[model samples]
Target: MTPSPESVTTMLYQHDDNGALLRTDLPFPRRSGKVRDVYDLGDNLLIVSTDRISAFDFILPSGIPDKGRILTQTSAFWFDHLDVRHHLLSTEVPEALSAQFDTEPLVGRVMVTEKASVIPFECVVRGYLEGSGLIEYQQTGEICGNRLPPGLKQCDRLPEAIFTPATKAEEGDHDENVSIGRMIADLGSDLALGLRKRSLDIYRKACQYAESRGILIADTKFEFGKVGDEVVLIDEVLTPDSSRFWAADDYQPGQAQPSFDKQFVREWLSTCGWDKKSDPPALPPEIIQRTKAKYEEAKKRLTQSEPTL
Candidate 1:
């Protein structure tokens, strides 16, 4: 059974004053990413989503309270609902490590997954014009070699969703958008085509369901991995951190639309006069609270309505 959002928030903040699990100390081989700490557990992996948040490729010092739990639970919701082969094995922490580590911090934010050879590209699907996609369209009338219809306004829904793949960048670097042909050249025709089809299929289904729940998934990126000969969806799926989610009732196409992700943090950072090069400044308490509310609202909206997929 899924716990209520209020209950989860209470549990998360009861112990820590800041209400952020910034990091985890585990006795396993670990690789810490921008927001998640991944520990290798022999055949499987223990992925712990921390409250750490990043923007403009920099990890911010302040974290949104309960952000990790929201992300993890949101991904778990999709993993259970979406009809796709995915890497999620379970959300429960393994029994062996229960005695060694404090389980309080890990609850609702842990995923035990099968480790697979990660595909080096981010499979991006866009149903709307925004972000880098909009900038590219304005300049060349295309995005990642997909020729978009001319005169498309900002946030305008595309006639059809398009698959745009990007090369995964190193830590603290940006992922470069590349053409589909480039994906085929590097990953071969069969594999590239397969990934594109899978990504689009998932996006279409998710878009339909999310729209019904009063949210529009403007765009989202997916990661896939190989387990022996089979390709499976890997990493977080359709979470606010990985996807651009907009309030359906409030959306307008002529200009930038309000989002449910870390856009507030980005907006704050953009105007705070901090150079994008150096260490990022800490977010104010109000920004943190507002950001946390946005993420919570998204999780509540998407997970509350269960539809036949």
Candidate 2:
């Protein structure tokens, strides 16, 4: 059963021994993303989901407790259920490295994955109009260079799920949405179109499953990579951070809907009076607890399993 927000509040607001894992020093080569620190392990990669959370392209001063575990578990759930080629190999960190790193940091938060040559675009599938899509529709009545029917309100379901590709951004830079034509120019028509097809397929299947679980997958981003002649899904799958999930019972199309992700963090940041140019204000304890509850609720709804320590 899902834990209540009040029940998780105390634990969720407490910091990890290592506060907001900014980076990791491992024997292997590592690259730190906004929330993950990945270690390159020759033929495989060790992907560690950290407690860190990012907003407005900036890593926040605080993190939601157990966030790493929630994301890792949620992605593992989807990767296990999805009928497609993916890069996940195992969620276990090697026993040999057990002594090298603290078990607390690695437990339920790491994956040993088959490495692939990662694609440089984000394959975004949107089922509802919000965020950039809403903004784009208001300005030009289009999204990802695809024209939409007139008079679509905020959070309204699209005519159908649309695959909108965007160029992957550098650290601290914004990811810019690109047209299908642009994607074709960047990675050939065959591969670009293939990404779109796979993205839409995954989104549709996920939507059906999430709806059954009382969650609406508004949209999600996917990263893919080339392994020999085939492109397989890589990076994180549909976790709260990657997808916009709304409570199915409370969903309303005309306005922003209550969500089960970092929408709370984003909303708080938007009104916190911090200039985008400056360091983001630290998230209040209440905000942290609320965010943690959202991530946990998302995992519970989709997987219907308690998070393992």
Candidate that would win on TM-score: 1
| Residue lDDT tens for model 1, 87-166 | 99999878887764447668788999999999999999999999999999999999999998898999999999999999
**What value does the lDDT take at residue 19 in candidate 2?**
54
Best by lDDT: 1
Query: Can you list the residue pairs that collide in candidate 1?
Result: none
Off by over 4 Å in 1: 1-17, 305-309
Q: What TM-score fits each model?
A: 0.93, 0.91
TM-score, candidate number 2: 0.91
Worst 10 residues of 1 by lDDT: 8-17
Off by over 4 Å in 2: 1-22, 99-101, 307-309
Q: Using alpha carbons, what is the TM-score of model 1?
A: 0.93
Q: What C-alpha lDDT does candidate 1 achieve relative to the native structure?
A: 0.90
